[model samples]
Target: MTRKLLHTALVLSLFLPGCRLENLSADQLDLITNSVSSTFKAARPISDEEEYYVGRAVAAKILTSYRLVNNRKLTDYVNLVGQAVAIHSEKPFTFGGYHFAILDSGEINAFACPGGIIFITRGMLDAVSNEDELAAVLAHEVGHINHRDGIGAISQARWTEALTTIGSQAAKTYGSKDVAKLVGLFEGSIDDVFKTLVVNGYGRSQEHAADLASLNYLAATGYDPHALKTFLDRLVARSGGSQGGIMKTHPATRDRVDNVAANMPEQKSDAAHFSERSRRFASILGK
Candidate 1:
């Protein structure tokens, strides 16, 4: 079987928990192929280097639409919180390592491109009440990067087409045709991730998985596991009827808050941490 088909089979088997892989029938295989084909044409395992380049492209696309925030203190603080949480993530280090930046937009949005390039809008920064809450959000984005959610959005067909064009070329460096094909694939890949992270949002399952991973990062970094829930609660209350920014880009706030509560760790008072962190946050963003 091709790599994309193999991946599809494995993913199908996962959802069937406890079912033997060998038990998969031809009909099931056909079903999987049809379902996947609608969304992807061909796929190959992306290397760390490829992911880094893709991430750079994605970041560049985002920069065209939004300016970077200019506050050095806020930027440094965000990186401090992001790095701390990232160090405790499932994938602690990445090909290019984690880098955090603030977008000047007040859109209450954050994005995690592949290869650990994370961005948070100034609106999101102002929305989070404390350091732990910021850590919670950043950790969730880190989970997306660790899981390679962005790369997974690319249609398998794009990779196959790009590879075919490259293989046809005889030059050591990409010729014009090869470069054009590669650039098209790269642009498609970026659009896939951009549409998910900004336009449509990830599926509920992906969002929940990231939330769980965020909790794990929080626990490992000595932040309150409830920090995410706290932030979500604020989001829910403030959302009132209109959904904007993060609400547009993430799962339902109520469902997420409930899930976090159900899976919350044993109560450990981080009142002191919250107190101290909020002071710093307020100093920067406001009361």
Candidate 2:
């Protein structure tokens, strides 16, 4: 028997009440040991720290394709708006905290990395009419993070293999070959997330769930939840069957708008609040 298996058996023997290690056949011992390991493997979920690392790598990969906005004022404004909504999300905090950035691309797209990194494109910012709309956008992305939609994109088989490798003695020893294998698995995971966020987009169910979550976050943060519906309405009107950027990656705009309207909270209007946020939004992004 392997040293790890033997160690597991010995540990189990000590803890198992009235169970004698010597009484069990070698086959029975091996079966028990394998069952314990399998149980642990099945129960393990990716840690927040691991998700943060994956998010960072995915962010880096995205940056390679789209340059970051060079204007500090614009960057800071986006972060401020993003954090305002994020603080009211289901997950108010993350392992690395939330970081929001703007991509210089004119594509109307946004991406939520696995942990707490969110990216919105210049076109998307322009698409929003006011700060509340921007908050709606950010809230939607935050929903993805709260639900772990990005991490869910990773193939189950790949994740299972990675967990098995991680639990092995070779991984513990950090042998060069094993280290390289781990790196390859990590890269595969990044690819899966990047593709989901940028290329294929999330499934319709995920998009709908995120929209519903966005409404909740917006209402909780004192932003108008109707802003989300309005944004989708604009998308549907502007899209006209065009398949690019967000239209390409997200579900049909009309469907999302319908979902939002169906689940919308009671309407609340504050003209003074609207004007103040609109002024702030225009000062930075323009009307």
Candidate 3:
């Protein structure tokens, strides 16, 4: 476990500022010390902190392509709901934790960066019929984060090189020369995650995995897992002639719907609570 933790810290160290190393608790510091004796060639794991920095870079790259929505109330509502459901995920506490944002575009898409930063487009938000549906959408993205699918996009060579360099250094703090090498690796890492997640999209198996994770999170949080199927059904119908955003990035809706149906959890409906949740959602989005 110490080696695993140290490997994670080393992977995260690429973009981490030297000053932040001072903030590490005794345990994290000890892990770094122990890592000096270990060879990084065998193992490389992206730590929570490293994931946060990588996710931030990816988020910045995404912002260049899409404008962010400036509605404070709606953004707060999303963050609240996203955090509530994210708490039940396997890897819950990332470096800075999860943050939910909205894009101003009308594209039917959502993006989940390496760590926990998630962005949902306006059109996607508009498609959700209720709070449960919105939760389902967010849960899917959370699944991606839980599975570390974003980091999986990074090249094997990059991971090996970065981890080897950090492990050789013996501490999170690095010299200026080390920093230069890391900066190059950092740029490459960012490009890997951005191109794979935002451009090429995850593979079919990954999408299925995320969808399964979404169902589990939704079920664990008491949100109807069926809401995912319903939302995807609507999204497919609403996807007109142009296959942009999710239509372009995600797998076929019919396939996703079937998979979701096969793995959906059973829950007794509470009409009263459901109605109240729906009312709040409508009021918030002015639907």
Candidate 4:
């Protein structure tokens, strides 16, 4: 699918709230019709390119609520660590490549957009003590992308209906009314993913699988797998009966801590590497 189609979907969802399609100029209608017609197809397994486009749309929806951090150095550092862990995952490359960004919110959360864009919140970064912990977090997010959890969050029924609508509408004339319907469907699919990410959260099994994946990636990349346990322990200790952000979105921290502890691999610590990475982490994001 084209970026133009993705952009048009986002623009229409955000700007056209209740406006009737008839109010638009002929040019605008043509743009909408053409964009929609170019994008969708009969429901099937989503392609990598389509996954990348969907991820971008979800990321755009997320940015509407949270501002991205503007610090280039910090952003670059995060990408460095993220890429380090991402390379070891099952699906190392995506159609759009991997990107990492920090969000300027103090919500203890991280979101993995469908393809490879990962957003770690300022609060989550603060919660991490060093590079290993940060790597642990990024690895966990990469696991979600590897597993296609974000794309899986979309409702199958809704997606099928959306594709069917496009297929049926494509045969005849693609009119403004058809465009509006498809746009609404597209917006609904986005909402399904958005709600799963921000509101309802992934299921326990998905979180468990991601945690296991994170441990594997961390060990493969030379970060202590137990770093994930340490981070989860901190979350458990600080939860204080609260339910918000990560605490709300992920499986219970206590359960995750136990799982990590149970499955943690045996690895020798490299003092020199740890010291160097810790120092670098502190340089960018103070202790």
How many pairs collide in each candidate, listed in order? Answer: 3, 0, 0, 0
RMSD of 1: 10.9
Candidates 3 and 4 compared: the better one by lDDT is: 4
How far residue 167's Cα lies from its native spot in candidate 3, in Å, is 22
Tens digit per residue, CA lDDT, model 1, 1-287: 88656755664554444544466566555554443443343454788888998899889988989999898998998999999999998789999999999999979889999899999998888787778889999999999998888888785546666545534532332234444456666568778877777787787778888999999999989888888998988888888876777888885578888888888877685778768888987887776
Question: lDDT tens string, model 3, 1-287?
Answer: 56655555554564453535447666655544444333342245777787899899999999999898989999999998899789989977888789999999877788899899999999888878899999998999999998888988885757577666775665445455665665577468788888877778888888999899988988888888888888888777777655677877775567888998898788866789789888889999998
Question: Across residues 1-287, which tens digit of lDDT does each residue of candidate 4 receive?
Answer: 55654555554554455545456666775756564553444245778998899899999999999999999999999999999999999998999999999999999999999999999999989989999999999999899999999888774756667656655643344467776776677567778888888898998889888999999999999998888998898888988989899989885567778888898989876889999999999999977
TM-score for each predicted model, relative to the true structure? 0.75, 0.80, 0.76, 0.78
Superposition error at 233 for model 1 (Å): 1.7
Each prediction's Cα lDDT score?
Answer: 0.79, 0.83, 0.79, 0.83
- What is the C-alpha lDDT profile of model 2 across 143-211, one tens digit per residue? 999999999887475656765664563212234565467557656878889999999999889999999
Error of 2 at 176 (Å): 12
Query: Candidate 4 at residue 35, lDDT?
Result: 43
**Which numbered prediction scores highest in TM-score against the true structure?**
2
> Which portions of model 4 show Cα errors greater than 4 Å?
1-42, 155-183
Give the lowest summed-lDDT range of ten residues in model 2: 166-175
The alpha-carbon deviation from the true structure for residue 18 of candidate 4, after best TM-score superposition, in angstroms, is 38
